[model samples]
Target: MREARMSAIGKGLRRRGRLMAQAVSPPRRNPDADPGSGPAPDPSWTAPIAPRLVPSPVFVLSSVRSGSTLLRVLLNSHSRIRAPHEMHLRTLHVRLSRSFSADAMRELDLDRAELEHLLWDRVLHLELTRSGKDVIVDKTPPNTLIWPRLHRCWPDARFVLLLRHPGAVVASLTERRQDPNPAAVRAEVLDYAERLDEARTHLNPHVITYEDLTADPEGVTRGLCDRLGVDWEPAMLDYGAQDHGTFRPQLGDWSETIRSGRVRPARTATPGVELPPRLRELAKAWGYPEEDTPTP
Candidate 1:
């Protein structure tokens, strides 16, 4: 009698699990939906084996002011890695001048997005070839926003998730803006935090924290090197010795800290600053304290 009862419970549990999975699953695509009724879908949407020149390029996914530039310069110092300044690949778009231009490309099995992907791939390949480096890392912070598209573009791409304290990020942005709105600044940070969290959830990325990175540069970088399948080079710590291309606005952080050619310690959260409920929750989720504590 006990065995029969246990069997019934197991079946019930399996049924519940299936129902839960169905509830969270994405809605099925409408078979009758017009393809032309919307802005065309990505070319690689259904094609998982898309051709890419640089198949396993690395992307540092982080928010602005999150020390991505510092990471870039550090990685750039590596002999086998070519970490370029902000390559805003997402901003590069392919426009079909004539109405039939897209159709012509379509006949050749390419769409606008696919064309742009080809261009992006070619550019990365060119940079890698020019640098004579085996690996290329694009540390564009904005790339975090369009991660899904990037995944579609290069399915084999690797991701590095860089995180910072929410409160500290807000404080940094507020100080940097010429005329800062407290609410706006907080909202912006929250937006980035949400997206970063989403990307972290979806991608099996190598995660690093600005606090730990600054406190133990060698230790953090050594682990990163392991993840990137490279030997830990002492030169990565001496990023100041490398020529990381031009460091200007729009390209990346051109502050005195980055230009100083050293890893400065990350600042703690502002004492009196109050984070929004969501930001506070996210900060906690990232292992930050509720109080303004210095991160080690």
Candidate 2:
């Protein structure tokens, strides 16, 4: 018994000594090891905790000039939904003032990305609270470019993929720019299209077309309301009757058509305007006719 007792005490002493050594000199990470070689951390890691203030918020993923502003106003007109002006949550960031700050945040199970997500959630929550709405929809077209980050932020978030004819989108953007370079304009639209395509491929989002939306606002909004688990209200069609913030730059389309307080017919693609090969292909994929030959 004495021998067993002595062995136990020695074992305990050795264990305590090892723990103290580890406490003094923690294990060093391999400096030369590839950080990305390991399996990526799950984007929904925080979902179990229900960390988001406004869970399952909606995002409209689209290229610029794709009628997202019109969609925003229609949804905002709903009693339960608040589709505000462009929040540009992507531009809002969390900066670590000191090197130790990141480490401190990590100790509390938050990295820089998570911190930004928290900030975004708080902003959405604040907006929703002020509007007294149960649902918040952010229709920032650029949000499609950073969808992976958004997925990490709010795993339960819903996406509304709004599509427009590539030709129409290119034309709209070209018209907006003061000194538009044709090549640059097409390239810019292509960039947005590619990101939007990537999002569509990965997410099972509700897809709507600008053409269809304008052609039948009631049918489109009813479908959206069904998806959002809300009753279809005719008030959604008369979006102008409700105050949907403002019609200004960086917010959304402030065009005369939007300000007209009614859904206008979507403009058709310009005649004989040949789309680039890539743009043509995307346009065809989106169910737009391969009407014009590829621009050389």
Q: Count the backbone clashes (under 3 Å) in each candidate.
A: 0, 0
Model 2: residues >4 Å from true position, as ranges? 1-50, 292-295
Q: Scored by Cα lDDT, where does model 1 land?
A: 0.87
lDDT measured at residue 127 in model 1 versus the true structure, 0 to 100: 97
Compared with the true structure, what per-residue lDDT tens digits does model 2 show for residues 60-142? 99999899999999999999999999999999999765545655766688877778888999999999999988999999999
Q: Give the TM-score of candidate 1.
A: 0.82
Model 1 alpha-carbon drift over 4 Å, by segment: 1-49, 293-296
lDDT of each: 0.87, 0.86
Q: Which ten residues in a row have the lowest lDDT in candidate 2?
A: 33-42
Q: What TM value does model 2 have? A: 0.82
